[model samples]
Target: MRLFIEVPVWLGDTIMASVAVENVMTHFKGAEVVVFGSKVATEVYKAHPSVSSVEVDESKQSKNRWQWLYQKTKTLGEFDLAVSFRRQWSTRFLLWCVNARQKARYRRLDKASIHQVKRYNDFAAHVLGVALPLGDLVLPFAPHSFARPTLGLNPGATYGSAKRWYPEEFAKVAIALSSTHDIVIFGGPSEQDIALEIETLLHEAHVTNVQNLAGKTTIAQLCAYIGGLAWFITNDSGPLHVSAAYKVNTVAIFGPTMNTETHGWHNPNERIVKLDLPCQPCMKRVCPLGHHACMRGVKAKDVLDKIALLA
Candidate 1:
């Protein structure tokens, strides 16, 4: 049997959806899975045992995007089943266009506080007519080994600046941890500036054992490197989820987003540091009010304390 799966666009969401993907693959045992999604999001399944191929969905770049997607999806031969983790209208159209014996797409449950991992698992369970147990975030990569003990710092939150903690605070944590571990700063192209700021702060503090890897790593490299970390200090972002997949001890600093819904899935080593302000979880790209007290109230000490307890 063959399966067609369209994952979510965001890297973090794709990681969270891995549990459902795994469940479906297991149920259809030995099915050759073909994944479709953004280039970055598709990387999560590249190393999966059941996935035969991955297609990057570049529909947005086409002149007639929907038509392009329909044409693109039609080229692939018939599949036994197709599943989509996205709820967009285009996804509905894509499922309709594809030549598949059966089709399933994720539908939001009435429960307000369902974690994303469970929601995806529930979607897969509903489609397969069984109760599926949630699994750990799956990123099948070779374990990375570093010469010295390494601590990772990720200060970028792709959702928006409102979710990001201060770079100076990240730098402070790096400096404190530097005495015992080498610092590895992680970020994507858009986060290079934030990574550089942290690097500068670390250097100014006379910490030399640091590598600024912002914008230099592919998604695979990011996974491998994060998988090797002794500890991770990051805002709620893609890398944090990556760390969780590898079971890396992680300290996730939450700002505008709700931790209850999006926190790392099935990772006992993960610790969340956030302020319980009444105005928290505004869920805005930018802070609505001028003051970002939701993030500002969270101090570097708060993160360090969490790490201390986790250690």
Candidate 2:
């Protein structure tokens, strides 16, 4: 059998949606699985050994993107089944264009899921006519040669500034942890400035073992780096989910997002640091009110306490 899976576009959602993709591969071990997604999305599946092939959709232009995808992915051949974990019209249009005999999609825009991992797993279960248990967000174990017991700091949240913890606070945490653990700061190309600020702060504090990998590593490299960390401290972002998926001891700082829905899925060792402000979990890219108390109220000491407890 041949299977084509449309992955989620967002980085964290793709990581959470990997649970269903893994199920599809497991139930049909002999079937070929082709995943269609963006660069980050495709990279998630590419890192997994279970996926047969990955088709990347690099068209960033909004005007003719769907048409471009339709033309580009029309040659995916025939598939026995196809499932789209995403609900957007473009993905649905691409699903229609794919030459798959069986097609399924999750369409719950009116309703919000308690958690997205459950949403993905439930979608796969509905399609397969069996209850697929939500399991670990599994990725290939990558070995890194960094001999020191390392602590990873992810200072950027792609969602926006509302979800980000203070960079200086992250630097403070690094300075505290750097006494015993070598610190590695991680970030995307867009987040290089934030990472640099943290690096500068660490250097000013006389913590010399810190390395800023922002803009230098790809998503695959970031995953490998997270896999080898003794601990990962991050905002509620993609790397948080990646570290949690890898079962790394993770401390996730949440502010404007729903912690219940987006916290590290199925990872018991994960600790979420957040302030219980009334305006919290606003679900906005930028905080609506002038005060970002939800994030601002969470102290560096609070995160350090969580890390100490993990020890």
Stretches of candidate 2 off by over 4 Å are 61-63, 109-113, 141-145
Q: Best-fitting candidate, measured by lDDT?
A: 1
In model 1, which regions exceed 4 Å deviation?
none
| Worst lDDT 10-window in candidate 1 | 105-114
Residue pairs in collision within model 1: none
Residue 288, model 1: Cα distance from true site in angstroms: 0.6
Give the 10-residue window scoring lowest on summed lDDT in candidate 2.
105-114
The CA lDDT at 299 in model 1 is 85
Question: Could you report the Cα RMSD, in angstroms, for every candidate shown?
Answer: 1.0, 1.7
- List, residue by residue over 150-202, the lDDT tens digit for candidate 2: 99999899879998888899988888889789999999999999999999999
Report lDDT per candidate.
0.91, 0.86
lDDT of 2 at 6: 86
